[model samples]
Target chain A: MGKPKKLLNNPVDVVTELIDGLTAACGGDLRRLDGRNAVVRTEIADGKVALLIGGGSGHEPMFPGFVGPNLADGAPCGEVFAAPTPDLILDTLSAVDRGRGVLMVYGNYAGDNMNFDIAAELAEEVGIVTRTVRVWDDVAAAPLDRITDRRGIAGDFFVIKVAGGAAAELSDLDEVYRVAVKARDNTRSMGVALAAGSIPETGERTFELPEDEIEIGMGAHGEPGIARRKITDADAIAEEMTDRILADLPFSAGDEVALLVNNLGATTCMEMLIVARKVHHVLKARGIAVHRTDVGSFLTCQEMAGLSITLMKLDGELKRYLDMPARSFAYSRA
Target chain B: MGKPKKLLNNPVDVVTELIDGLTAACGGDLRRLDGRNAVVRTEIADGKVALLIGGGSGHEPMFPGFVGPNLADGAPCGEVFAAPTPDLILDTLSAVDRGRGVLMVYGNYAGDNMNFDIAAELAEEVGIVTRTVRVWDDVAAAPLDRITDRRGIAGDFFVIKVAGGAAAELSDLDEVYRVAVKARDNTRSMGVALAAGSIPETGERTFELPEDEIEIGMGAHGEPGIARRKITDADAIAEEMTDRILADLPFSAGDEVALLVNNLGATTCMEMLIVARKVHHVLKARGIAVHRTDVGSFLTCQEMAGLSITLMKLDGELKRYLDMPARSFAYSRA
Candidate 1:
């Protein structure tokens, strides 16, 4: 296994160093919890349900950059490719929680489930209300009948955005959870990895891949996907991903959607724009309307070169929420 | 030389297809002039001096995606790693002119100079007033006496932003050009490249880089730089780049500025944030206050793995322009 050369100091300290760097660049919009691997919004708005989201770090803009107003109130960061512990989650929860209770959101993963579940129990013991919403939108992870068996991937962004927007619009915990469910249920995603993302700590690769080949449907963490094959045209890859996502959720003709051409890690924006061209053709041919499109590195593995295509079936409510004004170090809308 | 595998179709037509993809995904905010390799704002602001920027096309989000309100009025795209022809620039200038005149901006490349200079003469022949601003802020490219000999890299973003903001705020072409020149003069940048970005057309590497080594002060186009050595710690690399850039522009203590930690191409956001942390520390230790910091891929070279640090000294006017609200397919602020 070849480890991609990295510019890091003390591989074991990569995550801590990453957060320290992130908070400093953000000025005062973000802050770290004392002695904990977590971060919270510096100015928590009153009378709103706190939306908490987390997972393994490495997906830069996703887990931490998503912490701001109209987004996740706080995020408990885990080590690269590892989930946070219950205690870490509790720290962020306590710091961000106001009188409005809390809603926890994350992708479907074993470590994440166990840690978050334990933290929810801990929160209950402390008498703070908590609700959970797990994302299972990666159709390639499981059959339609076993949807919950699917692992969460980049589709978490759409769900989180809706959840954040809902939280900002209302104070009721159940209402926020309901819209979050709606967003998660309507979303679907699939990806193809042309290269593996390496972890700096172990100087190890997450998976092995042959040059001139690609793995279709690879997860964000480099987990097993549907198939691997010789490298082919980008249009074919985009078609494969779009067809799978559209069919699983049955996002058919006349349906409106917010399209996401997310770079898994190191795919260039130029390549992504090409992929978006094909995706647009695919959706247009089916009479679907693309309400909006986001093309950039939203979620990522560490320097993995590939991308994911996500479609969020949008309604009047979801569209309004998606268009709401939001700003962060990673993403913003004017 | 290793050709990093890419996801593109009909490599020769990549640029045209990229323009097609970008305009399509943008959902009507941007459009291409019929029968030309140029992109323009869907609705140009009337009576405003047109801001035109162009360069090679491989630097995604720079030449085309930057075309929108409060930014470049239009951008003529050249082939990958090549400059656009004067005819292409003429086509854009002809279409975007609104009586106020045109101001063209681009990196300090020889080919770009000839083409843009020719276009300026042609614009005069057609009775449309025109001015030009060439960016030369790469510290490693030249010594102080030969500052204009430096190649422009990610610093183009800051110059274009200030130019666009000025164009939107004032009706005078010379004033817009003056602010752009000031912005260009105040900015300084330096970068390090770990890997080379390959061209899809020939599947050939731009330059060779040994494993376990990096080239400090590398230009975005893989141009030769100051030194190449074994990979070192992030802090040391940041210090080398910061010291060179700060000294070149004399960004002394108590100076305020906007700092840009730009990814060259395939460098992940995780690596960039780590670099940002070190950069922030270096500036703080020198008593320099970072007014703002942007960490992401604002400009890139295919899939090159490395990054550049850009600092633009901000005066009251420059800061005002820097803070102006602008949104494009690739960048935005809420």
Candidate 2:
């Protein structure tokens, strides 16, 4: 691939420029932190337990697109596929933190973990209470005994969504943290990659695979997966992936789940729907009830071609939070 | 290029299977018409002026995804990039029509115009009153004098949104048709394509371009556009596209409009945001106010890499209908 065609000015400014665009899109409801690559709600409620979500920038709607009513109060965006720096995170945390406290939720990644930890310590020094909930829901990354070693993927949407609601309604920082942790524990996701996305700065393909092969359980950034095999039918792929997720969660026959078929990047909505169809069938056959299904581009990896299936087992509390009204740049619920 | 590495079982069944998946994803709120390639709301109110929208497939989330509360009451889907047959359209029309009659909204294309017109006549013979409002919002396709010759692009979203709200609230089909016609008249759109998406049945690209070249004002199905040039910065592109759109409608300094930066298919959200940022700047500089902004994949051409900007000048009546809450598989509002 010769310099994947893109509409950009300077690759180095991708994060800042995109944040500027996102803030503009929000119609004055969001504002950027002064001299920092971060955004916060212009109307954050006083004394409300604030929800703070951040990660790399390449995943467009994830870190920033999700900042709006009933969602993250602020997001500190990082360089493409890189974690936000400690100072940037600290500024955003302080900006969104009300007198009540702040709850930080992000994917389970080493750089993000370190940076957020540092930011939390800095906030504590300044006399602001903060709590952290790292989401690790990708089952393919590690076995159940070592869940923390696994990476967080699209499951971050569920954790953030539940945490956002809890922060808005619960008022207590510890209660919000508990809700976020519960969401992370109940959510599971797996991804498959058919093609790789190009990096914004270099225009270089993230990874390469044989023309006819696909990597099952691939990471969003083209990390190695469990197996690489020739591409197969949508039904077969959905069956196998669904079975793996169901068995891993040990989701019982009567459990209810909110199903998500996330377009990793470039996969068409048609393919995602087909995969969702098969996954629903698999779930039905195994006696699992789908309380709701969301299929779209919640989290993406540039223009990489593939998708991930996420199932968040829902209880009355999780369901109430997930079903609550939300309005954001990337997601909304009636 | 080679076979496109799609996750499909049978290429010929792409439309049916996707419809199945969409209905399943709707959680029983939508159902497929018996033995027809169409879907309708399961709980349409009696004696309501029904809204029916349909068009070719390939644009996943467009026809079917828009079927739900406060949106299209039904949609008849066609094969990939092909218009639905008259029989399919008529069946869907009859299914959605209440005693108050039905209103049809769709893109302005030769095939769609012919099929929907025929379906309207067929419905008339059965005492089911029907009216049609074709969206011709692509300014790049034709000059102002020949507005009807233009192709409908992402502007269809605005038209359908207004019409869906009107049909649900207004008991008279003629009143609903008037609102839809106003929406179609006020909306304008233009698109640019960086890469072509493949057809599901045959891994064939809809169109081809040199690696570094981009096509501006291209239609959804690889239709010829007005300009082909080397890729440039997002600001320049956004400025040019927004200027052309503003000139077409002569959107005045004091006018307020709803803006949409729609991803045709594979373009990343980051790029769309950057484009949106520039468009907002241009609109502000010209003194035109944006009432609301939506950025996402509303209408797409499979996995084509490009986006379109749509502007719909809003009046009090238009704004009322546009702001109505809607719920669908692809779109939702709080």
Candidate 3:
């Protein structure tokens, strides 16, 4: 295979250089705390709860882009698709703690869970308040009994949006964490990947699947998919992905939802909208009301050649918070 | 060549369907005029100057996205990569014609210019005041004396922003047109293409070059690039593109500029930012003061592997307006 063209001082220098560039782009609203691999917001409201979220580095604007006035205050940048160290997590907690407490939100993954668990233990020794809310929205990542054990995907949009709104309102750590968990519980997502991705450092394919085929339930990390099938029409692919997610989540007639049609990096906007229309058709046929809809690349997987459908079953409170104004590098609502 | 995926229903079906979707998405602020292809903001300020803009449809969040509170009052949607008809332009002018008159802003394309000129003539005959400003920002599209002869690329971003800010303050048509013209005069852009794009409808490639080569000074419509050379690092690409654009414009050492690093399409955020770093280095080496910077996938060529750099020579007033709060589908500042 031909090598991917990239520009860097050294193979190992990609992540650190990108982090510094991100800080500059954010115009001081974000900062990397010295002596640690953690990023913190410049403005921290005293007496108001704080939120710190993060994941692997390649998912730009995900955990990092979600940081701002009404969103996350810190995001510990991890290795490419790898979790951050426990010390880094503790450093982020220390930086964001305003005596009101902090909530740690991220996708459910083995490495992240263990590291964050250790960080929480460390915070407890200092009497710093800490809470963790695991987002498990990828219906294809696990079966029903293991739903709580599934990995997260673009549904983290809803999770961060709700959690940020709660944190901005001076809600305590427990309250913020509760709402975030509820948001994650009410959301379901499934993705299909049409192409494989290459890691910048190693120049190696993250995962291997035959060309001219697709994985219906590919995770962000190039994880093994749930099913394999021939590449097909856009509508067919949409139907398959949406069908499985709706069936898994059990949205009833008259149910209301907020749909997020997410692009996994390389998928075009034209493709994302096709996914959105299919989602609309599916929900409308079930007499489900789509309270609000965002059709864009809110979360991404670095040009993964696919899209994901995230449906957050909405309640009155969730809808209100969902409608709240937000601004980020990749998305904004005023 | 393999068959290209059908990203939308059909090429002919896309513009109308997208407009319909946008109407639903705009939530009461937008309405399509009766019996015409025009969209006007319902809350258009009475007795305030009206601003109108339009072009090909593929660049969503462009002409249409800029229509709102502090921007153009209306925009006419056209076929993908094709200009709207004279009738559409005339209808848009008529719908937005308040007592204060209207200004027409569009990229400098042959079909768009002729059609808009005809619309202006027709509107003038009907006793409605109208002024037109053609944006010509692509330095590589044509020579300096024939700048107006070149096509507009991403530099239209600065044009719309300044014009919109002027119109929002209820500036007269003449002032809005003047500021818009000034913005166009001061802006210059040049692009580089790594891969060719398809029209979606035809399922045919727009242009083709060898895999190991790149086309510098590329146009947005996949027109022939100024130079085709062997692909190299991002730094080398930036050097050639920046040198050509800066030489054509000839800026002074201490000049202040607002830079826009736009992804044509398909270029990942990581790649785009890499280009951005080089752009900054080039401008700084010339002792220029960079006022504000915007780097994102603003203008696109439907997954084409390319990027464009737009340098807007700015004064204090222009800088303030450019930095003012802007809320659009794809761009936002608060």
Q: What ranges in model 2 sit over 4 Å off?
A: B1-3
Taken in order, the candidates have interface RMSDs of 1.0, 0.8, 3.0
Tens digit of lDDT per residue, candidate 2, span A42-133? 99999899999999989878888888888899999999999999999999999998899999999999999999999999999999999999
Chain A TM-score of each model, in the order shown? 0.98, 0.99, 0.95
Clash list (residue pairs), candidate 3 = A265-A303, A266-A303
Ranking by lDDT: 2, 1, 3
Q: Residue-pair clashes per candidate, as listed?
A: 0, 0, 2
Candidate 1 residue-wise lDDT, B118-166, digit = tens: 9999999999999999999899999989988999988999999999999
List TM-scores for all candidates, in order. 0.99, 0.99, 0.92
Q: Residue-wise lDDT of candidate 3 within B1-334, one digit each (tens)?
A: 2434443565666666556545544546677677444567887767888889898877665667667766778888778788988888988888887778888888999989989999989998998898888888888888999887888899988988888888777457788787878888899999988876677677676888686888888888897768898888777888778788788877779998888888776666666666666777788898887776777776677767688999999987677667777655455667
lDDT of 1 by residue, A125-174 (tens): 99878999999988999999999899998889998888988998888999
Mark the 10 consecutive residues where model 2 chain B has the least summed lDDT.
B1-10
